[model samples]
Target chain A: MAPSRPYQPLLLRLLHGLNSIFVIGAIITGFWTYDTYDGRWGRLPLPQFKEIESIHGTFGLYALLLLPIFALYAFRRGQRRLIQPDTLAKLTQVGKPIWWYTLHRITNTVMLLALTFAVFSGKMMSEKWLPQGEFDHTWYYLHLIAWAVMILCISVHLLMSARVGGVSLLLSILDLKFRPQDSPALWSGHIRNWLSQRFKGTPK
Target chain B: MKQNLALTIIEIIVFISIIAAWIIPLLPKLEPEPNTGSLILSAPGAVWLIPVAAKQNS
Candidate 1:
């Protein structure tokens, strides 16, 4: 018999959903903006559309605003479980060549930071810089680079999550139709097993 | 632990560099332009100001 893990907090689940939607919207709208501004990146011609650019910029701003809230929640709720010495010790012995968890956290943080700057600079460029005929090539250059980096980082994050958490875990986040499994129960059972083994001083 | 520390330091450096790269351009600097164009824009030239290209001349 094993202890049952509690269900994920509703607020965290909602935030995750919102964050995922905004991120995907931002990426799509970003491509639209790129085509509108500089269409050379894509193979097919994507004409610039003012409406699309506006949508992209708006979504980007929204994501930027939501990030700190999510970060705070993650820190407050998971601080002990995520960063405990015991957890780290377990992780170090997992025998996985790649530190998937560490990389996932680092990449997500980097992407968020990059996205924040992208949105901030974009707003500044649109409101102050662009209107004044201050077409700073540097801003455009950095924005493009940031967009590329963010995309790359996100791709890597998705791949790693799928690899480590399995397809079902990844799909569960997407609200897709999948066979029901008592994931919380399973996770709690795992924790109980680990704790017992560790306490009993048995090799895992 | 050492590896994690090293990675954190590297990430911080990269983050700072990115911020600096963006902020540097925002600072005001003297940009000299040729004085050959008319200092004052006429009414039609004023229309040009509405578009991004028109402001480039100034």
Candidate 2:
């Protein structure tokens, strides 16, 4: 067979793609919610509403369920793609492309961490906390901090994705083409094999 | 060509949004009175009650 496009796995594509959408929606709507209620640090000029919290919260809820699943898949299959301190130490010794690759992995890890914390803190935060105009809440502050972290992480992620994978890698997640080998029917077997291999040498 | 154009546009929009996100948080905080008798509406984000004002940092 001809060499196919280097694509993300079908499962990762779906999970990560949807997760990306949820994260994007949640973040934008979240800004609206933050602007409408908190806006203590800064605010978007976008129109504000009270239900923005629920909208953002709904996305958060969805992410809380799926992101961990994607994380599991990533940890199992693409663990090497994750950045570690040791890997980062070699960054300066590498070429520019490798540096970009390292940066990309680091940003991806940051994105996952930021998303997890944002959702966790957000779930703990109530609209009442801000509706009553309360600003000293712990969870609320953490959520705000997560927002800034997400911004930074996403900026790096986008830049690295463009530099390393360029548009092809960025667009791959959006590609709907399915190869015969990647058919959904085969996913179950692939997942089973993956799971078996992951546990093959592990101590029970 | 078309595919590349779309991808570039997406990259630009994402880049802009990232810049906006970074900029928005650093601008300034809106000071809300602790005892304002205001029923802050949530969601349906198009609605505005009090004057819509954002503090811009120079």
Candidate 3:
């Protein structure tokens, strides 16, 4: 049999790359901010650091802003293809992982919104915002809630991925020969279908 | 049943770790703030430091 072609879609790859960079940025910056403002709270106290905190917040803001674009893409196109039974089966060898896919979409959407809220609220509380005292309690509560939601969603996402195939599935994004034997043409075809459907009426 | 139990345990552990990370700090605590000037470090700063150090070493 011919070697099964790589299955990752270009758009998926792009979104995954963007999301990875932004999330890593958010994590590093978040830790820095914690170190600066609330290191006492962390189990492993990170040294107080501020220089990157701004960068972290900035990346987080970008991530938050990009989320709506991601969501719009997901809801309009990615959702249909990703949730297809054949796709899920090919991806996980499981029959329609509906719960997982739904949770994934919902969590991702919520995470982006939460991140946005957290960043805005945090900025309000920061020295950057004028009349900073106006935002203290409300900002603090919103930031805390948003962080909590993002953390929980991420944990669920990781755990679900692990359950499907441990680290291999997670790493498969980078592995070229990531597709299973049964469905060789699915990924690229899905992307083409998505683009065509999306641009059907628009001018070339 | 066994697999379900194992998954449950793992879930519980993750949940506990998250809770502990948040709760432990609330308990009474005091420590001197480290001098920020002596060690100028930030989140992404560590990434740059390594390459610079490697260049200097080379």
Candidate 4:
């Protein structure tokens, strides 16, 4: 028999899919905004559009809104995907599969941190600054740096996932067929149980 | 131990590079700009809730 295809939880797929859409949108629009405004680094040959900043800000706002929810899910349900205490030790295994997996986890964690910095720095910026020829804002510079780091982190994330689990793992996140237990109908109850568990030992 | 040391060194370099990227630009003294309205309603699907005018001003 052929090997069974991997499955992902519906909620992970939904959140990841939406977050990816918004983040990627922000990334592309962010570049356009850069090209249009502060091309001190270099300018693309593409046409410049001043309104791209507003569009980029819109995508960034959406990404910012989705970030907390995605981060909560990542920390709570998908904790294994992030770096663990033993990750450093695992990285020492150099050529081993475990090493690649450890690197993948590190990349995942870095991606989360990079996105947080990008959005938080972006939130600190005023839309008027770019249009008004004011680009020296510390927050704006930090946001640009965050954008660069996010790109690098995302690249490493894809490379590490491909190295560790191959194409199957990459496809799993987009998989639509989920087990009954992972159904959306049970989400409320699951959340309630998780909340209760968290508060179980707390003072009344 | 050699491999571990090598990996540790690389990690340290990467961490320092990121920190440098963040800090180097801010080292120069720059004047802080005063406040302006933020892009709170800039995102798609967001509504702008215009505050009601004061009764006396109206």
Predictions in order: lDDT: 0.57, 0.70, 0.53, 0.77
Models 1 onward score TM values of 0.56, 0.70, 0.52, 0.76
Best by lDDT: 4
Q: lDDT tens string, model 1, B1-58?
A: 3234433443455445445645654555333334533233223113222233556755
Q: Write the per-residue lDDT of candidate 3 for residues B9-42, one digit (tens) a residue.
A: 4334434433443344344433322542222223
Per-residue accuracy of model 4 over B1-58 as CA lDDT, tens digit each: 1233433443454444445544543443323223432222223334342322332355
Query: Pairing residues by index, what is the TM-score of model 3?
Result: 0.52
Q: Clashes in each model (backbone N, CA, C under 3 Å)? A: 1, 10, 0, 0
Candidate 2 is graded, for docking, as incorrect
Q: Clashes in model 2: which pairs? A: A39-B30, A40-B29, A41-B28, A49-B43, A50-B41, A50-B42, A50-B43, A51-B42, A51-B43, A52-B43
Chain B, TM-score, each prediction?
A: 0.41, 0.43, 0.43, 0.43
Error of 4 at A196 (Å): 1.6
Residue A125 C-alpha lDDT in model 4: 78
Best by DockQ: 1
Residues A1-204 of candidate 3 have per-residue lDDT tens digits of: 884333555555666668768866776676666556554455456565556657776777676556556555554445543233343334453346665654454454445445545555554444342223232466656665666666777787677666544676666666543335324457667567667867895423
Weakest lDDT window of 10 consecutive positions for candidate 4 chain B: B33-42
Candidate 4 has a DockQ of 0.05
lDDT of 4 by residue, A12-123 (tens): 8999999899988999999999999889999989798989998998998888778768877876588777777677788899998888888898888778778877887787
Q: Per-residue lDDT of A54-169 in model 2, one digit per residue for the tens?
A: 88888887877676576766655665566654554658867777777877777776676677677667766656777789889887888889878888888888888888887888
Cα lDDT tens digits for candidate 2, B1-58:
1133432343344344334433443443334434553333333233333433422221
The C-alpha local distance difference test score for the whole of candidate 3 amounts to 0.53
